[model samples]
Target: MHKKQKGEAAVITLVIVMILVMVGGLFFGLPLWNRWRAGIGGEAELRQAEFNRQIATLEAKQELESAEYLNQAEVLRARGVAEANRIVADGLGGPDGYLRYLWIQGLSKGSTPQVIYIPTEAGLPVLEAGKR
Candidate 1:
């Protein structure tokens, strides 16, 4: 009877020890698992940040190219206008020639001015249609 009681007490102590070891292992392993999951999430966030930066750089490059093209087009348009003005100036002999061209252009129109002043050496006035 004494030996049987000793055996039963030994078995109970071993079972309790096993339960305590299992609880301690779980307590220690939970933090390590949480840290590993956080590391994975952090790595994913870093990759997303890099992707966003690359997209921003690409957009800036495209915008710069568009601006350069617009500037070139504006310069070309201005040069064309300057060239046209030079050709017109060459066709008209001088200031008086340009004035004569304007007079001819006005005459070609249907409407005429009632009082017209023609520039001469003395600045004389020319009457249109009927003038008193």
Candidate 2:
């Protein structure tokens, strides 16, 4: 009878240990799994943000190149006019003003331009028909 009682107590202890282990796992393991999933999601969001920044930079560069090309074309046209007329026209109605106007228009349409601004003494020079 003493030996049988000892065996039964041992079995009960084993069963209690097993149940405790399962309960501990239920409490701890699930949270760890959830944390790992959240970490993965955060990493993916960071990667996506980086990709978006790169794309925006590429787009800005392209727009700058376009603006530079347009500026060069305007300079060439001005040179041609100067050679033909023998008098440099005065005022913001010249090539630079026209280019700035065009750039502003493009920017308004969501196109970034390389030459962001034309510098003047106080601020941007006002466009006029005839002025120095």
Compare the candidates by TM-score and give the number of the best one: 1
What does candidate 1's lDDT look like per residue over 6-48, in tens digits? 9999999999999899889889988998999999999999999
After superposing candidate 1 on the true structure, give the runs of residues whose Cα lies further than 4 Å from its correct spot. 1-22, 94-132
Among these predicted structures, which one has the highest lDDT?
1
Candidate 1: residue 131 lDDT (0-100): 48
Per residue, candidate 2 scores C-alpha lDDT tens digits across 37-98 of: 99999999999999999999999999999999999999999999776443322344666765
Alpha-carbon TM-score of each model against the true structure:
0.56, 0.47
Q: Relative to the unseen true structure, what is the Cα RMSD of model 1?
A: 6.6
What overall lDDT, based on C-alpha atoms, would model 2 receive against the true structure? 0.81
lDDT of every predicted structure (CA atoms):
0.85, 0.81
Whole-model lDDT for model 1 versus the true structure? 0.85
